[model samples]
Target: MLRKAEDVLTTTDVRRRQVDERIRRLESRLVREHDEVPPSLVHEWIERASARFGDARVRDFVPLLVERAVRASVLGFSSDQHEMSGTWLPDWARNTARRLLADELPRRWAHTAGVARRARQVARVLPVEERDLLVAAAWVHDIGYAAELADTGLHSLDGARYLLRAGLSRRVCGLVAHHSGASAVAELTGMAEGLAEFGDERGRLRDALWYADMTTSPDGHPTTVEERLAEIRRRRGPDDPVVRALAINGDERLAAVRRIHRLLRRTYKPARG
Candidate 1:
């Protein structure tokens, strides 16, 4: 079971393969749909990002990331999915998911990026094996929010289901599905299927994503749980979805956030897994 879990994570192979496949798919799509970007330019970024990550394979995702950015432009995505996906990127998938996120919820794009950035920050604290999934999920955490699929409005559930349908790995799919969990949002959106679909992940990947998202600011900056909650209240007020989410969760979200924060501190303070 232990080795099986490691093999399941696309931590290396599937991620690279997906990046390569995405580039090919997007290039063909662009040709059919009109040029979203130059093939050469997209290739350039993938090459550059690959070099930056110090992993030759990391080079594969750049093309895919750039293609998504161009698509985001076509969609009038205000969120700069390219930038968000690229934030703190280490020569790879950092910006790969941005275009999709941008297409989904430009308003929440920055927030998702912020979560990814924090995931990068905390990567140093996690086991090397777990970091890849954490980073990948960071980029993909909010993919369900795509306007076309934001059906349940609980982006996690919707996004997870979408990836699973697209044939993504169970580990990556699970991470995205329940990154932050929809308990609060699910109560309101009425998406029990998405909620129930997120099965047990093999590692701390889900927990890491949840912790990072809860601590980060929606404006794409870092903040504490105490501050994050206060800001939610101060900005969204009591009648808003977030406020109402809190009400429905019976403060469970807040408390869970608090617990996660404590774990993050202990896990990340010395910066070792």
Candidate 2:
């Protein structure tokens, strides 16, 4: 659990100077930001969040902090619900990824599509950039299966690291590397640290990614937690490395997912728009 999330905002021992630099560049007209909703719904996010979080000075960072808090809440709640639900794939993440799988591997894409759809649904709570990152991660999650890279046998880590090396955001890299931690795939391949760098440690972002990966199926679709666990049992039979690892940690992980799912659903419920 490398909890040393150094908030190294790009670079600096001089903190305020850095924030001041960004603030100085602020646009004259702040877009009166809203969640990803219709123009008609502009007031909805303000109304809802104001109702729950209440009024505070609408300072420059307040909105971002509030948004981050909302994202964290979503992750926390979703984790809990998934634990109980068993079928814990972050709904949006699973759905979007499922679709990608279907498109790439048409023969088996339907199943994968289900996974993508669920991933997408779960990702909806995130900011647009974060959501895009999640969707991209979910879609390409299984790309390691494509013969050229399967030899390493650590899809999440191996896949993500490759992309990061070429140049991708740390956030995107994080999801790709740690999503589901990919079956002890990292440990087996001695790349867990590298994978962890691509996100997926123990924070809210990691939790959200974790819940998304676990809840979705290899075949890609929503399902009950029991059914999901049963599928794992069936897929691996008994004593498979991945299966063993999942079962050993199943209780804690399931609980995490369930909590996140419940909280996120409430927090991110569609805006009035």
Candidate 3:
């Protein structure tokens, strides 16, 4: 019985070392990618993933399972899509947003879900190359609202800054910074110049992102642009800086939404008999 107990202890120690080595290798591979995801963040994800398997009887597969889970968390790949190529920005964005906002800001998470859902629907109107990017922007647009990330007190700029450091493309960072007429608000808060760092993007991608955000309700439901605007006004009240910024740029936002509607209508095709 003592020999058996010693064997079990040795087995457990070996498994722990194996898991750590596998995680280290996985971290090295991930850090080589373009984003070069932070090693600390990668370790945190590995710990979270490993925690889920604590009750399992068989420990042989734990290291492999944790590696796969952490890789998915880092690269935003679903289990079936691990072998697939092309950047999965939207998935990464969704995971990042969830990590930051799900526990700390439930309502904001709902809003983000709604906007990302709407962005996916609207992406059909954009060119193939731009579709996922629009969805990606929608996913992380409000991450600055996360309590720990709200450094600038301006969610748009703060969120954009976070994404930029996370190695997101400049275009995505720009969209997050300027979503929903944030330029007017930035100007009001003296952050307009800061926003320019991402450069101003024009045309359909911008319009579609705005349309997705404006048409989604805070509860993650579809809503007309007017209703959505009214909801914000009601929630924030007229004294809010966001509401005040809306007063300045609301018309321009409305125009962008209308432009998207026209584009959608133009692309609409009646069912063929």
Which model scores highest in TM-score? Answer: 3
Please identify model 1 stretches exceeding 4 Å from their true place: 1-96, 103-107, 200-203, 248-273
| lDDT score, candidate 1, position 4 | 81
Runs in model 3 lying further than 4 Å from the true structure: 1-86, 270-273
State each model's C-alpha RMSD to the native: 20.7, 18.9, 17.6
List lDDT for all candidates, in order: 0.58, 0.50, 0.76
RMSD of 2: 18.9
> What is the TM-score (0 to 1) of candidate 3?
0.67
In candidate 1, where is summed lDDT lowest over 10 consecutive residues?
77-86
Candidates ranked by TM-score = 3, 1, 2
Task: Report the CA-based lDDT of candidate 1 relative to the real structure.
Answer: 0.58
Instruction: Output the TM-score of candidate 2.
Output: 0.53
- Of the pair 2 and 3, which is ahead by lDDT? 3
Clashing pairs in 1: 46-62, 49-91, 50-59, 85-94, 85-95, 86-95, 104-146
